[model samples]
Target: MPFAHAVMHEENGVFGISFPDFPGCTTGADSEEEAIRKADEVLTFHVAGMLEDGEVLPVRRSLKELLSDPEAKEGLAKGVLFLARYELPRKSVRINISMDETLIEAIDRAAEHANQSRSGFLADAARQRIRDLLKAE
Candidate 1:
């Protein structure tokens, strides 16, 4: 299944890569080929963590619909195409938690390394922990 999203643009001498659906997910390279190569690595970890959590994947919007929206022009320019076959809807829930500063900092570092925002990282961590708990039961 398709497991990642990427958008690219040429600015100055470098190609900037960004993942639209994934906040804080970004990587850049000197060329299109190099950027795509790096994107593969970034996507692997992002999808792996999701798989571990049994989390559903993101849906791919239709090209027609996307194109109709002016906002989507930028994504189209960057070659952002969603493969419909890989689309999977996700379920969301709200929760509250309290943790130590050290732990929070660690999570933040982990999130940065994974190219995800703090919220995404915490959600992934929580999901994985819950999955492990269920498996152990």
Candidate 2:
């Protein structure tokens, strides 16, 4: 995966990280390095979840491009701004799940066979688990 652009700054005595491509995704830490680490984790999870469910990742704008946008400026002024490459596939759904690792592994393998990433496979597994639970209840 490519390194997503991370905007780092200090706020309220802590470091803040934001991705311009993904709105509503932000994190803070006590230091710049920590902030970047948190940003990397957050981006990975966000991208993985999005890919699992097949959701479109919004294209991110470069810092220079963002600075030219009035809306972007307003967001930055409000202490929120960031961007990343479209990291995952796009889809939409809602589900509940409670499954063990064995089941999860099975789904993962199936997804791999289908050429889908683990996230995508686990998403389907979650859906199935939910359906089974509902049927049982």
Candidate 3:
């Protein structure tokens, strides 16, 4: 997991988020909670697109370092700062595992309903679980 610094500002009751390290990557919502959630999603997809396009990801900068930059400083002055977690795309590898027969059937049914392969469904479930656990911390 990698975290990006996000600045959230509210205007006319709508919340907007921006990543200084990733210029042009922005998202918004009607509430703070939604803004935070959207920030993570936006950053994750933005980074993935960059990786697909052979663009080098920017270095993660600390709050102190960001403050030294005028643009980031200005954004920080008008908004709240938080870390948005993003996952880097990786090459797929096959693995062998065993699980209860009933559980496997249930997973297959759900995956079919969601129109996703078993691996994709399982990966998404695992990621959501990890995010929930992190939020609990």
Sorted by lDDT, highest first, which candidate order results? 3, 2, 1
Model 1 worst lDDT run, 10 consecutive residues? 80-89
Between 1 and 3, whose TM-score is larger?
Answer: 3
Candidate 3 lowest-lDDT run of ten: 128-137
Clashing pairs in 3: none
In model 3, how many backbone clashes occur? 0
The better-scoring model by lDDT among 1 and 3 is: 3
lDDT of 3 by residue, 61-130 (tens): 9888999999999999999989999989888889999999999999999999999999988877876676
For candidate 2, write residues 1-137 as lDDT tens digits.
Answer: 56565667786788777776666766677876666656766676667666556788666567788788786665577664443333343465656777798987887779889998776666666656754543333
Angstrom error at residue 20, model 3: 0.7
RMSD of each: 12.1, 10.4, 7.5
Worst 10 residues of 2 by lDDT: 81-90
lDDT computed for candidate 2: 0.65
Once fitted onto the true fold, the runs of candidate 2 whose alpha carbons sit more than 4 angstroms away are 75-137
